[model samples]
Target: MAWFDEVAKFNTPQLRLAHITDCHLFCDIDGEYFAVNTAKHFSSALTHMAQQPLDAVIFGGDLTQDHSFESYLLFAQLIADSPLTCPVFWVPGNHDEISLMQRISGGQIKSAKRLIASGFDILLVNSKGPTPAGWVSEQHINELSEVLAASQQPAVVFCHHNPLPINGYLDKHMLENGPQLLNVLHNSGLVNHLFHGHVHNDYQFKFRSVDILSTPASSVQFTKHSIDWQQQNMGASYRLITLERLNTAEPLCVKSELIWLNE
Candidate 1:
């Protein structure tokens, strides 16, 4: 069965959003991981993101390394200092404490799972588990189904873990119930894109006509196809997604570009 019997049509103007993920920040200003200063890299990424004229910014997850209250404070502070004027949205990752994040954000960082922007519905799903692996609970799946059925607009889903395996050591840590999640999306017939983090590498592919995108970390880029943990010197990167509706009778078209902060 197709995900959509008839696609939602729109003639909306272009909507550009910036996506930053896997910040791995720490309470300490000088925290390091595997010899990489995560805080420094995150600052660099923030500096560059502040320069972009974005409609909104989405953090894909892993906002902190220690999941401490101070870490969340730092995340909020950094955004407050940035030149980004648009609304900010975020989902939780394995390294994040969702309640703590919500408490400290003080409405500045919205935890709403759904957003309507430029004629499209953005669905935020929480795929974080108690352990390093990932799972989507029944509650989220039900909420997603309800939201998709309620909206008559093109949709983009964002989560922390990749629903599809990337075929590396990281595969073991992917969403354990990815097939279930995929089934929900395929049945929704409304989702046009899936954006995720966790893998710490850049990847793009199509599944059932939906764009599946994975972004590199804002701290360290992981070496793909490695049997174990490996790091590359690649600088921080983020994704810029442009959504446009050329006609009122056609499906919304999406263009996503991965921007490297080092450049």
Candidate 2:
């Protein structure tokens, strides 16, 4: 699943996307064992990304600490307040409370929806359902069917959980219906890339015909797929995606490289 990576490049023929996820911002960084100033780390990361030309920024979810209202408002403001002039899209997570986010002020939900409508048709692809378990039901699958059917530009999807299991144990936390979801995506005939969050470790893999990608959480990078939580690295980080659409009738080519906050 090695995507074409160019250390020096900017924008794309049709879209310059910035994919970030799992901010999980806390009011303070002094948690018990983990001291993660998620907001500040995210702010610094945005400082770098905002300066670059972008078609839109797509956020895979987990924007707050335990889905707090203030955290969501603050995160929404963080994006709106950024120097970026492009649209922004969001997909919810198990750590997010959708209703609270929908009510947050200053275009939290509106801005995301506008991006979905204007640019590449986005599928929210809720990965938070069955809260305790990782799963995307058949209903969401039907919605994806219609969404991809209606998309004009290449479609980009964001979800809280990865659909492809990277390892055995974490496979227990992947979309329970991952096989089905992937099958539909491969058949949808329009999806160009599928970006995900949840593993807390950055990885790229191929499942069927689509490129399956996962990003490190903005607040933590877990130890590579182990049941021992004690072994997790839990560092602060995020990613900067550089997309290049070749000047051909073919679909766009997207390659994302990491910009770690701890760096």
Candidate 3:
């Protein structure tokens, strides 16, 4: 069945979503990445998310570390077994396979890229590239522009790569055509915010008027500007975001908070 076959309505005044990223799951159930148990941390994230009354959940990207199909299956199984009833919108990271992700999506994890919730249009961008670096093609930019041109509603875009540079070691892996993306958003005048994952740590900045946020990884986080992983006690984290309009005559308001897991 298609993801949008049965469209659901969000009657609430506000729409809330939990954004988790960089799960980096392995094929082996007990496998560990950099001494961190990816599966256990992801499971913990799911458990925590299930407790919240969320409208949706966004899996930011980097769903696997070893690029194994079984790892994707493990990711699907974990979501299916979780108590979260909200839809999961996802994008592919550099480490993920497009075909495998599509195959497992459409249930808890939806395959749809465009979402309409609470009077806002949430669009997902695919920034995955052939290499570790991110790239957004001209076609994608054009499509996004066309969509924005046709819609007067507020927009929130989600993607796997950071469109702006952080001036660190990870900058090489950022979106190659970030300036083009910013150009579109700058011209659209409808996009209020942009959220992404690839950085492995929390980041906040502004490109013109758009507020950009990067979520921390659910498995392990990399130290900023470090060439190697310096083992420390950086735990898994996720972002909780709420979108609402105080009045019919006003612009949309966005509020976000970063939550860190004790595990």
Candidate 4:
């Protein structure tokens, strides 16, 4: 059955995307993270997503817990078996091995830094760092600026680390070069939103005109505003982002929601 048949239709020009992050799947199917079965939750989340009409799926990173080859293989296999057949895009999180992911995905999962679709440009940037923290280098900022300069279409940027501090212990692990990156994004008049994963919580805020959003983990959710590691009872969650193409004189309407799996 078609996924969109049950949902209300919109006449406006729009693009719908599924944003699933921080799966943290281990090599074993029975592996658990903080008492929560990672593989089981991931399967449940994918099953829910299969019912949605998604133009694309974005894995914001932290795709594995043990960072094992087997874990990646399982992730790829699950996606191949699921109802989600759209193009998948991914960036490296602090825990990810980009080369291994690329090899395992067999080029089906594109490591595209920039994607143009439905009147908007999506920019994916690598924020992986030597430590658990993340940093967006000056070179990446320059590349983003160049990409934005090359196109007049509005843009949404994605990374594995939160670009702005969330006022918690996780703040120390946020993007080290956040100020520089934010400056570049704000100066670029075309950037509409910035989406990221790392904190394992759902958060939304604005940095100037650019909306900043963070999604919870597909395996487990972390307690918000805690100085220590704390797990929340919330189940696995993902984000749905829709960008509506408006008239030339009006700005594009960007809407998003956090969908959580009960099971």
The lDDT leader among the candidates is 3
The C-alpha local distance difference test score for the whole of candidate 4 amounts to 0.80
Query: Per-residue alpha-carbon lDDT of model 2 for 162-261, expressed as tens digits?
Result: 8877774556667777778878888887675788887778788887788888888766666775665532435455666655445546665666777665
lDDT of 1 by residue, 1-263 (tens): 12122122223467778888998988886888666788778778777877887777789999889878898888888777766667678878888887887786554566566666556777778888878789887876786787788877678888899888887788888989987887788778777789999999987767776778998998888889788888875888889988776564778787889989773
TM-score of each model, paired residue for residue: 0.91, 0.81, 0.93, 0.91
Instruction: List the RMSD of every prediction in angstroms.
Output: 4.7, 6.5, 2.5, 6.1
User: What's the true lDDT of residue 17 in model 3?
Assistant: 90
- Decide which is better by TM-score, 1 or 3: 3
Give lDDT for model 1: 0.79
Clashes of 1: 2
Full candidate order by TM-score, most accurate first: 3, 4, 1, 2
Of models 1 and 4, which has the larger lDDT?
A: 4
Distance from true location, Cα of 98 in model 1, Å: 0.7
**lDDT of the structure predicted as candidate 2:** 0.64
Count of clashes, each model:
2, 0, 0, 0
Per-residue error (Å), model 2, residue 91:
0.7
Ranked candidates (lDDT, high to low): 3, 4, 1, 2
Q: In candidate 2, residue 15 scores what lDDT?
A: 53
Is candidate 1 or 3 superior in lDDT? 3
Residue 247 lDDT in candidate 2: 51
lDDT digits (tens) for residues 1-263 of candidate 4: 21111112223367788888998989998988888888888888887887888777789999889989899998888887777766678888888998887776544465556666556667787889888899877666676787778777687888999988887778888989876787788898988689999999988888887888998899888888888878875888999988777565667677889998876
TM-score for candidate 2, please give it. Answer: 0.81
- Of the two candidates 1 and 2, the one with more favorable lDDT, higher being better, is 1
